[model samples]
Target: MGDEAGTANQGAPNAGVSKSVSVRELVNRLKLEVIVGEEALDRPIRRSKVHRPGLEFAGYYDFFPIEHVQVLGKKEITYLHKLTHQERDERIGNVVKYHPPCFVVTWNQDGLEYLTAHCRKEGIPLLRTPQTTTEFMMLADGYLMKQLAPEIQVHGVCVTVAGTGILLRGRSGIGKSETALALIRRGHRLVADDAVVLKKVNPQVLLGTHNGTTREFLALRSVGLMNVVRVYGRGAFQDETRIVLDIELVPWKENELYNDLQLEPQTSEYMGVRVPCIQIPLQPGRDVAALIEAAAHNWYLQTQGYSAADEFMRRLQQQ
Candidate 1:
């Protein structure tokens, strides 16, 4: 499950910064044939949205999103076909001079000699796909959203426990992987081990996925690297999940105070999203796996507006 050649290097500048993808990567991922401008495949695509160049090709360039991947569908191409050669040349020529990131022709429309020629001369990559305009745009936009989404890689073990995504963080050899392995044995799903890539999908959502090379695999200190999917079937591993809780495993401090009564809420921020956080002290003979499972269940209950601590307080007040 190694990551594709270029995806490993696709990281944001800062923790919450936006990221860009290359035209070459999109070409490879989208299976688009490069009709022209092969040399310009290295151009950066900063925008995730694709634009249909109908307005721009009609000589209205104001507020044009030149950074977007220009898409030419049937209507746009047919409109171009309606124009005389000289008229088409002037309008599309103006477009080429702007040097938009790239152009994509969908539905395998022909009569793109001028478009291809202009793109090649201006060093703008022009690609063609057999998919319809709508399909191609949707696929490209979806991929771009994932690629350009704000992401941060953390050193932790992510697993799906009782339908809630929990990220376990702690010092080296603090039993993160071992705990995850135990949870997997209990019918939970392992998301990522060692390195988990967390992406902010929405303002309140943080999605976690495995590093490409480690997808569907976990490294146990006792057994080295093992494929969870191969050993436990597909149900044992998941590619990604929306992280909802953070569990920190720490060595037990003899004199340290612990939160026995969960009256107050604790949270930790990742990729600009705040997630419920709990600390479980690691000590000999402690069942950390069961504790984490309990934490997940507790968090799920909190989400549903039911907290045992709150209920207990209400009963005491009534008394």
Candidate 2:
């Protein structure tokens, strides 16, 4: 499906950069109630890790991550209630002095007058939610991770063949789009065409999606731009996919060697994550689309602990 809101921006300076999420965005996304410092909702959340200030409430502030969103649950609130007024004020005051992005009170825990007062004085956002501490932390952490993840723009075509995500990379006019269209006709789904936005969501996962305004649209040289959803229906498109394989197309050279056996696996790194890679030579008579489909199937087999090249070698040794 085409996403008008998720349109890719080719000229954006921050397209591939790590981004910060505003406390206002978080508040709206999580449906949190603004307890105090409504004006401070513009504060930026730079870290994805949520913190529970139990130690801070106990008057221990060593190695505190003030940039993280602080959470106050039943345990922390109960302990704070046990403390004297001066002790509670001093502890909360010490935390608010650092001016964290925000403080979120979870499980509808009340008795936050001290927290609200300190936050209002320091212009720090104080938010409340009905979700439990664990649930809220998980939701907030997941949202922050996706928003603050490192991303990069790649010039290629991304498609899902069978069940694997494949990225087609090559120079201009190398038939990347044409191959993707062919794959779509073969019951595959197109993730993105032209420019692909790759986000490193974690240490081991790189997500691929269409870059602004170009989602579900494919450019086929002489055929011009075609809306994939209009031509192939909704089943032929996907919003995003986890990239697992990269296949680079190059013009066939008579003297150059090619990996016909595919005995040695290749990999390409994007934003610090490496994905399985292969290079295919383009020729006038070669069916590049079918080759890509085969590659995808082979990738799936490898993931299932079956390698065709290894099997071929084992058979050869037996012969």
Please identify model 1 stretches exceeding 4 Å from their true place.
1-20, 253-261, 283-285, 304-319
- Per-residue CA lDDT of model 1 for 165-226, tens digit only, reads 98888778999999999999999999999988988767998888987999988888768899
Local distance difference test scores for all models: 0.85, 0.85
Cα distance off (Å), candidate 2, residue 177: 1.0
What lDDT score goes with residue 134 in model 2?
94
User: Alpha carbon lDDT of residue 157, candidate 2?
Assistant: 93
lDDT of 2: 0.85
TM-score of each: 0.80, 0.87
What does candidate 1 score on TM? 0.80
Q: Considering only N, C-alpha and C atoms within 3 Å, which residue pairs clash in candidate 1?
A: none
